[model samples]
Target: MSSNTILSLVTPTISSPGVGSGLDVNGIITKLMAIESIPMRNLQKQQSGLQNEISALGQLTSSLSTFQTAMQGLTTAQLQA
Candidate 1:
């Protein structure tokens, strides 16, 4: 993604509050909270990335273990021969 998109995602736009008593205070708070959650979203993204890396490492380890086992079997067969 472009830098602008990333910046927009991290930064929130604030609008002027409503002019009268009928103003939707709840809506305003919701919008403000949504903006506040940008950091949380970023952290979640980071967490997801870490989880993926961990999964990849686990797969690599399993593959290496399997290879070691196979190599040992081959060595045993050669020694018998």
Candidate 2:
């Protein structure tokens, strides 16, 4: 990229205070609560997904054990033959 493009990208714009300039402590607290809830919601989703993965892994392990038992039976039959 060019130098002018980099300068424009790095420059910060100045602006006047927003509409909530005189916002009270209660308003800030409400906003912070909303922000904090977002992470809690995301954590819940991640935990649910992890639970599903664990359940699937448990099923896979059971299936593998069953397959191994079948293989052992087959080997024994071959040895008898």
User: Number of clashing residue pairs in every model?
Assistant: 0, 0
Lowest summed lDDT across 10 adjacent residues in model 2 is found at: 14-23
Model 1 per-residue lDDT tens digits across residues 20-53: 6579988988999999999999999999999999
TM-score for all models, in order of appearance: 0.62, 0.53
lDDT of each: 0.91, 0.88
Q: What is the overall TM-score of model 2 with all chains considered together?
A: 0.53
TM-score of decoy 1: 0.62
lDDT of 2 by residue, 22-78 (tens): 747677779999998998999999999999999999999999999989887786669
List pairs with backbone clashes in candidate 1. Answer: none
